[model samples]
Target: MPRPGARDPQAPVATADVSTAAESMPRGQRSAARPIPALTLVSHPTAARIGERLLLQGLLAGREVALSRNAPDFTRPGEPLGLPLGDPFLSRKPVLFVPVGEGVRVVPGDEGRCTCAGEPLHGGREFGPEELARGVPLEFSGRTVLLLHLAPPPEAHAPASLGMVGQSAALHGLRRHIERVADVDVPVLIRGETGAGKELVAQALHARSRRGGPFISVNLGAIPKELAAAELFGSVRGAFTGAQRDREGFFRAAQGGTLFLDEVGEASPEVQVMLLRVLETGEMYPVGASRPVATDVRLVAATDADLEAQIADGRFRAPLLHRLAGYELRIPPLRERREDIGPLFLHFARQELEALGEAHLLTPSDPYAPPWVPAALAVRLLLYPWPGNIRQLRNVAKQLVIGSRGQSFLELDARLAQELRLPQTAPHRTPPPGAPTPAPAPEPEAAARRKSTEVGEEELLAALRAHDWDVKKAAHHLGIARSSIYDLIERSPSIRLAGDLSVEELTLCFHACGGNLDEMVRRLEVSKRALNRRVKELGLVPKDA
Candidate 1:
């Protein structure tokens, strides 16, 4: 029988890597199973209705491959397989597949929407689990959608950096661009905010490239203006004052491989002129050297600065920017892709635990460290704007893991606020003038079962307010599980949440705080995490970030 919620056993879920799944199957069953398809064009009417009549499926085995519907052209060929779907409506190249883990993943090309078993697949989402289990011969969009599980492709392990760890469209687009240009010899420009992992993207490009030479990175901004040329283009013996021995620069060091020039925007005028000449002629002249050396390097340049503005100001050369930006990749900041925070934190935390030789501390049932588990941590993580991006988050996770002293809730809220540079203040409230106030606080554990059972929306709201709108605290007061409290929040949409500020008012305050999250938290008089959530709910993007 197929797995639970599965439609058929003939085509099991594609979530698991092909190797593991194939090895698990019985020898006889494995041989009987159909081969995985490089391109499966389903022609069901329901699929047609969903604008996905042509479903081009393929394997992601580390190497990049393309799935196309049109006939293959010698001038512009598709990788792995090229099957004609007989549907002219579909684009020639609808999607590209990049292997992740032991499984395959598909990235939609310019094609609008892709569906599996009638359910739409968002960007970076794989076609497996429910859709794969639905099997072949399923009817959709007024035609029969076909499933072909051809023999699995060879397994190739992907590097950890390739695991960009997000399902956001921005990340998917970045991966797609990298796959398209990785194998080719070209100049690429990577632009993003500082600490946004620009070097990681450069490394990913080099890792995926066919060229197997050493990867060298040069930080142009760090080099003194006078030494720029010598640092990048080398200097021969007796070329300058010290009469030092001949030294190979970044260009020669990265021969036959990839050369990443970080902060290329910092290139001096003389350096820019030389760089332009070398990029155009495929050679560079060493400082004080009579002859030009033949350079064989795939150049990938990155900058957090606005090169266009620099060009306009005559600080950066237009031609050089044009040359370096043969293909451009933009990496969105952490605040922009908050969905990735939880996974990234867990990944970093595990790495720290393993490094500290405390792997056993993470039980299979609770891999996340105590006090600051995934569920609670996710709320805090998603709330902050993550000004320092991934680098900042990694530091935070390391601190949390090392500091969790076997407490129930890991009493680090104050530490986190301080570390985040947020202002520290206790929550407070005062009764209205002349208002008759007061009743003794109820002993939560001693509260009668009847009173707990009689809890209603008003009681829940009061508890939440008493605890400063903490979900867990409110749940305990109501004698219910935290998950049940979450369910209540979801089911009762009309219930007034604790916060009284409107979206516009919160946005105005955020702007007034000059997009500083710490300042905004203090100004709003809320917990750092709570403020983060409200900002997200209002779809606020810190102007500075």
Candidate 2:
């Protein structure tokens, strides 16, 4: 009888070098290497000890592990190994976990109480490998959340976070990426969505390098195309109108240090050529300067755009891209690391609380008081697809601390409820003796629409019409989480992307709405920016044209 989440003895584990190298691989290829199942403790009421990981590295099909109040501890994995649960509310008898083919069979003990994929486990449930990769969230005893995910066992080689928070395995992988590339002077490409902290990655690289000069950052997209060349490679006095003294561009400003070019995909053709020349020849010719000046600077570039697509369309240079990507690192989006939300929210919330002189809010009002942050709320936070990544999460944390200033627990007003896709009204329950009150736990999973997979196309359209296309309200009405409905909308045949709309339809809607973007959005049922882009592409909008 093995304990729950047991490690497989023969699995290929990640040494520091392997972990760092894998960061550059395509996600599909990377998944092939991390084939073993693992559990990471992501959340707890007392979160100081969270982020413990257990790599069931070699646990094969038919092997079993158990979980209970005092399940046996297995701690062979390094750095962030999982610890004992020690939850008094858990049953004394072990809940069994058996690996089926590519999924896991979770059989609850007679008294076991846990929620899987927002479902209560009364008997047994199966979680497929895909769900595990996205992190199968398991809430236990109403006080803990464990993420069942893939593991490749990261070593504790990198110690510096450089202002990053959370101890998720993904974060550990990111740390390894930074360390492995830091000492080298090669051009590193950081690819991630906006607000995913590309600049932080850039800084970490610079800090570890031997370069002693200043680190300079510039957003090429923000600079006008006419000035991009001068902005990056500097200009001589009298080179152009109002060029007072010789302007030292970002390249010279950074000198021997790093020049971090953000939004590199947005660089103009002229600027791209200039970048390529300097990267290849170690020399740059400033605007109106006859002589090429010798330069030495490590370059790191970041972008959210599809550079490959840009190259295929002849919008970006292929050789410039290849030069920039001598090394590459992809930051995992926040949704992919949902396990970190609790700790990240708490980390940001406490900082805001401290700034407002309300640090006391971090502590319970009494031994029996409810948590300032409710567990149900935690579930919603974890499930949200954070398009804005860590920056948006931090903003929400500040909002939570400030919005619930006078309350005993964080309360959702209409704004927050709409934002979180939870109802404004929450159920309440009393606390036991010497225990903190838990908000009413989430209602047991409703059988009808428990999953997005269960909802049909007809049902999805009906919900959309019933709610006037208000996604939040419709998602609430359908009993699916916000991300699920958004996904469904993406998949629905009737919902047209702006690209799918014809010029004739857009022009008709444009005139019908009197060129009002908001009205066009309402009448066309398309996103404002996408619609605007399509309109501009067709020369329907004069200024854009």
- Tell me the tens digit of each residue's lDDT in model 1 across 1-545: 01134222222212211112344346786554333333332221111111122222234324745644454321101134423433334445555656444344555564344444334334634434222322222211222233322323222532123756643324544665677668656677887656778898888888888347899989998999998888889999989988488879888998888889999988999999998877777778999899989887878889866565466456788888877776677776675544355457667867877787765444333312222342223334544556567898888978877786443232356778565532122211223336576664543332322343456654564345334455655666566766677567554432333264567767888886677776564334344566677777777876544
**Clash totals for all candidate models:** 20, 7
Stretches off by above 4 angstroms in model 1 are 1-161, 364-371, 374-376, 405-415, 421-545
Go through the candidates in order and give each one's C-alpha lDDT. 0.56, 0.69
Q: Over the stretch 199-300, how does candidate 2's per-residue lDDT look in tens digits? A: 988988988884477899999889999998998899999999989999888889888788899999999899889888887777899998999988878788
Q: What's the alpha carbon RMSD for model 1?
A: 22.6
Question: Where is the poorest 10-residue window by lDDT in model 1?
Answer: 44-53
RMSD after CA superposition, every candidate: 22.6, 14.7
Q: Which numbered prediction scores highest in lDDT against the true structure? A: 2
